[model samples]
Target: MRRLRNDLPYTFRPARPKDWFRPPALWLNRHWLLERKYRVTAIEEQGFERVRELDATGDSMLLAPNHADHADPHLMMEIGRRYELPFHFMAAREVFEVSKRASWALQSMGVFSVDRDGPDVSAIKMALSILAAGKPLVLYPEGEIYHHHERLDPLHEGVASIGMKACGRVSEGRQVWLVPVGMRFLHDPSVEATFRDRLTRLEDRIGWTPKPKMDLDERILRLGQGVLGLKESEFQVNVAAGGIQDRLESLCGQLLEMVEARMGSDGAAGTAPERVRAMRYRIRRRLLDVDHPPGEDERTLLLDDLDRVFAALQAHSYIGDYLLAEPTLDRRAETIMKLEEDLLGFPLYPSARTARILAGEPISISEMLQRGELPRKGGASALTSLLEERLSRLIEVPAGAACSTELVSRQSGETG
Candidate 1:
């Protein structure tokens, strides 16, 4: 997981796509950066024709992909290049603040910044405009890159809301489509050795002797428990005794409640991410107010609250049963990688991998609304559930079976 930073004020950055720069930028990303930096050796795409057919009709499209890795945007850009389509991307504001050159490059490639902590009306309007203009807009429903490739985080409802609202804004004959894209990464078998080495390094850092004789899965679970215990102690909460999943939930709740108590605000009832966003928004509103800036002591306290909010969200990202359910090699490696990133403060360099890009059949927003299939009262939530179900099935496509060009209905499990 990328570290969260709260030093910068929230600002909206709109997309300024330069057609001249996108092709070469995409070329460099595909030819060099993805292969060399992200270790992606191959990319296999399925259901791209769905996007092409939608584009042919001049219909507006919103590409909703699971964001399991940081390389997802570049991967999507490569896909757009292949289909001869240009895309507009909605990204977190912190990314644009990384550097001026990065912000410039991202904007040139049609990426815009969004503040996840607050009501970012500007970002929503930008998305509506992009879709209204009959262009492909890419939004990650799973807002954060949690690095859990096999499982998707709870999706934000904003994507569904944007798609539904865009439908009403498009021209008469132009429909709006929500395309659920599933992205999965397969690590090369050679990376198993690297994970073993990483495990040893992590043990050393934690002041424990390397458990070479222990089962790999057991070692990872033990490390995770220890880390969880340390966090509990740090927060002055009694170490909960139970299964990892239960303990994780308990700790996350305690942390969020702690922040809420400090802020004297009842947090919004939802997932941990939602509660964190609420707390952060309240805290930052005071922190960022220039006219009535927080006093030095108040500022210090608010910053601490922000840190705890980040920690709670991070803990929530690690679903304990992920590895136990499947125990695939990829899951084990991802677990180790996440540990190294959290404990060691930097992610391990991933080994060579192949990315499977699966685009599901498009969900026509206008058609659903027109047919009264989607009720306006809770349409966003309903549409979100549908998209989530489709994306979950798409990501579950077996490695050997995902490369086929045939359109496989996620519902029927049949091939044409």
Candidate 2:
């Protein structure tokens, strides 16, 4: 250990439920925690006021927020700064480790790692400890930001998993809460001309094309600073208790049952890939729950991943980003080799567990692709010819529509 320099302290601090939403330390937060170059309205007075209510409750909390723009975390930090405690954010490892200032900002903001591609064991352990120690954590259940839409990426069970694990592990399952926070921003001038005016100009400067995520953040932060006009010292906070996860689960279960009850004879044309979707959804949800105000860099890694996924799906192409390789080991072959070690021919994928038992073996990407997960959205039947025409579709199509296009295409030969 080259002695932890002017960097952030590694020693874990004792945390309290309320402490989760405040700025971490004076040094890191003072001028720029959520400071902005532009002035906007609705920062502290409008948007974050709801979160203030959620934080005062005395329990180990899991703050789940809908992801809209990158400003989601930034806005959260603004509230935290006002209250004066930092969240232990679970962020991409590479993004955090890239530079000293970024690392310090993250560490001071209580940052940690959750590698999206690899095992997030360390991050998971870190999160459980924070809750066990009695602190609240923040996570984006959606896992990635998107165009603000009405539908949520069906609440991933991974969030439930973390809650389950933390509940048991934290003080033997005593005080645990999952706090849901929603932000409704009005960039439209009529709703809040004060916020809207600044928002438009900032959006122009940043050139978000449709919308820039950073500008959204700057708008909220500016509203927090300029519109609210805190005396550079005065700050306010509010907190409220939400029902336990069990209570929420019961309610959600009831709702789901009602939905299923009404779903009669909407005959299934195809089975939803429930198993695969559940797994992906869970991993993403878990990553979101365990991390806190992910700094800009970490946010980019995840956003980039989402972009790659969407691009691959839209283009009818296999997804692989040579540029964004995340495995610690340098070579791609090494990453594959590690996975091979675990499955011994089972195509374990991104894991090398149980290597000693099987000895040596070859990795299998085909097996993973066959299972409909390896290449991600590329595996969809409409996206992949093998899964579409050759497998299930042939059985369902009308007989006349099933013939090859070229076989009966001699229009001139049968000019009836």
Best by TM-score: 1
Against the true structure, candidate 1 reaches a TM-score of: 0.94
What is the model-wide C-alpha lDDT for candidate 1?
0.85
The alpha-carbon deviation from the true structure for residue 219 of candidate 2, after best TM-score superposition, in angstroms, is 25
Q: Model 1 has how many clashing residue pairs? A: 0
Clashing pairs in 1: none
Give the Å error, residue 115, model 2: 1.0
Q: Model 1, range 329-378, lDDT digits (tens) per residue?
A: 99987888788888998666568888899999999999999999999778
Worst 10-residue lDDT window for candidate 2 reads 352-361
Model 2: per-residue lDDT, tens digit, 1-416? 00101112122322123334333443233233322211122331222333344335435666655553334566555445545434556654544655766655566566665654334666778888876666657766555443222223333334445654665565532455555554322232232223344344433433333233444333333322231122111212111134222222333233222323432212321112122222233324433644564566755544433332222121111112221233222222222222222213221122111100000111122334446543443332322222212212222222233111110114214221
